[model samples]
Target: MSAFESIPHFDDSRAAAGQQARVEDTRIAAQQFRQHMLNGPKVRYFESFDLITVPYPVRYGLRNAFSRERFVEYMHIQNRLFVVQFDTPDGLKTLLVSPSDHERNIETPFFRRLQDRTAAWLTKLIIKRQSSVPQILERIGLRPEDVDYITYDHLHTQDVRRWLGTDKTPGLLPNATLLVHWREWESAKDLNPYQADWYCPGGIAGIPESKVIGFDGSIMLGDGVALMHTPGHTEGNHSIVVHTDEGLWVTSENGVSVDAYAPLLSTASGVADYAKMIGTEVIINGNTLENAVDQYISMVQEATVAGPSRRDPRFPNVFPSSEMTPFWMFPGTRPAFYVGHARHGTLQRP
Candidate 1:
């Protein structure tokens, strides 16, 4: 049986009490996690791929950057794949988090409809040959069979058939199981109109049930690693949490950079001013406004769990899986602070 634990208290309600309750619950969970697992075996982390740079709406990113003509229309986001390895009671475990298949990802309706060959030219120009996951795995001396689990924060623009295989095609990872939340798994297979824009159609189709693990609530893979449901970006969105010598670090796509988590500490041109003007603690990614209140509270939970960054104590260690990287193409949208890649411990072959 898998280690399944009830999520302490998750209140996504719009009431003020629900908001405060969420914050308190998250703080309590953070305390317990640190107390019990802070010194547990550290996971070996590596940035498996730099992946791709895509345009993101500025209004969705900074929220207040909406009417500002000086700011770029879109922010260039660099999505990355992370390889995390750790020892568990069962055995040595390797998890591929956010292992996005870029070429297949473009099949999402939003990108597919972009005409004038813009998408094709951009893909040829921006995608780097060496940044493919297969190459990175080989370079790091890991075989396809070495991966035990594959997961993403949410399944937006992701087509897992390439990795997990269908009836006709062979899978890239022969022995890997896809670990995902039950809600997310269901939503991707049968998307609502509200969700149609971002998700790739037929993304999760045709995989044998045995090859997938559909879980609910928060789960501890082992030691200091956790998959906690943070929601808001999507209903089933969760954050990857890790404990290292430095401190706890959380990864998700709720926010694009350090500026979103700690807007007051942001040196980005208008981020701090906007947050101060609105009297809000954190900024939402705003791409989907369906559940802004829930998204707002989820960001608080992530920041609480991540604690402070050793590099910059003023900011929390809540990193974005698709981070906002500096691009000359979009000059004014550069993130004042970005955690380019997080590497911890050494990768030991199992």
Candidate 2:
């Protein structure tokens, strides 16, 4: 038997000490993360939000999901998995967005084979130890049970069945429910042939129906949060809108960088200007299976829903949700902005 499996009891002093160290380490990590969110450099690509925060996986510190030439105009970017928490009457309602593929075991034949052919830049981004969602949660002081709902902008390269469990196995988050758009959920179930390589095979297959909650259109999840349909990249693509002290911050892969969303203000002015001159607004092509017209429309929706850009010169409150970058680059290191004071939008009491 393995040494871990052979442990007879849970009360061993060494084990207890290890547990304590883990918790303590996690607490320290959380504190540092809070600082990073507050103090990280406010890249033009990101608009600062006072209410919403990135509570876990401070930085993946890897390159863009897209390759070298895919986004040639851009220099480098990093992918970030954000644990966005919102304050609500029901208590702290947590939403886990863009949770990356944490179940990819590097030791497996699949990873081994892929790694042999994988580019050097992607190697650091897909490290197995850091990619496991369960370990990530533990490191961030979040009990999987604490997650009320989990969803992604789309179903690209996801393996959520592991999180939701099957008929025989239990899900990692016992109390959590997956909130997915109906179209997106269906698209995942019936992946297109051309997009086969982009999605996780059987990502959502065989999950208990009770664990999935499908929404038809835009649904408000109480206390300054809402899910809105923004399809263009994929038929089921959507973005999460959070009302923060700085205004609305959206989470999506539709626009890879702030420049994609706001071309006029981006560094790629020559190209952005040319596109606008011709009536086409340039946005990052998230999923190849997309409609340019639809993508333009979706980007408009995101801009419209987002709160007004700030006037402060130090850091304007507007940015792309995640920074997608190539290797040899790191994510923003600014400290957390919204400490404990997240001014959520409220409704008129009838």
Candidate 3:
């Protein structure tokens, strides 16, 4: 059986209709109340283990509207980001999840003086033409005063200052760690042009290399939850996996969206080179490891270059096939699913 067959088909229309028809159920209200205490007040959040449905505005072309669906559709499939408050025993931690480094405006004087002109130039350009991070926060119903931690899957502009330890926000958590991919923290500046500010003074001082956690394949965070390295999008791309009484549910960060992945081959190929190198060195260690590594790399390169024309034979009936399909299919279509058991582990309602 393929990965696609192993998962259930998420009915978007049924869900949309159900949400549309939902009366103010007292159960929902009670659950929201509990979530409010857990996540904290002034928390306006959205979650999608699948595709993110909110249409956040993007800059460029006539398509640059501040609509959610438009943004979702534009990205090809749903990519989720959350404006949430992560509450711990110590206190409430407010964070904007998954803020892209290349998607924020950076006007700091320190960044303007960077030595790497190419990266610096690109940073400025991305900032000039990108969506405003503050605006995104507002759209997601988050208030500046309510924010404490800006957690990110990878280094994005909003998370950069925190990562670099140069953020001047008053009463900000002094010891809050900027969780990021260890590989990106080590080599992103050279590989990704958007990371120029990360290497600068204001940026560099705050983000010490010591704060990073380099785990093989996955790492456990908070309770029993784990973050798995799924790779493919960027070298260190990962998905958040929560093991609840409901079984195992994985949040496809930049991995394959549920809708897209439903039809096996519709899944976008991840980074072939990294996958091969890591898989060979780690997962597939054996006598034929060398050949397996070479074959894996070659297969990834071929699939990548072949684009949509290359289809995995397992599931051939999927439509709108293309290797380079955009991230979201429709804005707000990829709502995050809360997977948990009905009896023991329930998804905390918002």
Best by lDDT: 1
lDDT of candidate 1 over 237-347, digit per residue (tens): 888888776678788998988789988777656788878888878888877665777788778878877888998888898779988777766666767678887777778
- Per residue, candidate 2 scores C-alpha lDDT tens digits across 1-350 of 01001111112212224634533443343234323333322211112222112111211111122122233322333334556565554555666766655454233333345557767666555432324466656655778787778888887767776677777789888888788888988877776576655676666778898988887655656545656666767877877766555655666767655555554444332434444555444445544536545555566556555534553322223344444332223223222121112233331111
What is each predicted model's overall lDDT from 0 to 1? 0.77, 0.51, 0.32
Off by over 4 Å in 1: 1-18, 44-48, 66-71, 115-130
Using lDDT as the yardstick, the better of models 2 and 3 is 2
The clash numbers for all candidates, in the given order, read: 0, 31, 25
lDDT-based ranking? 1, 2, 3
lDDT of 1: 0.77
- What is candidate 1's TM-score against the reference? 0.91
TM-score of each: 0.91, 0.64, 0.39
RMSD of 2: 17.3
Ranking of all candidate structures by their TM-score, best first: 1, 2, 3
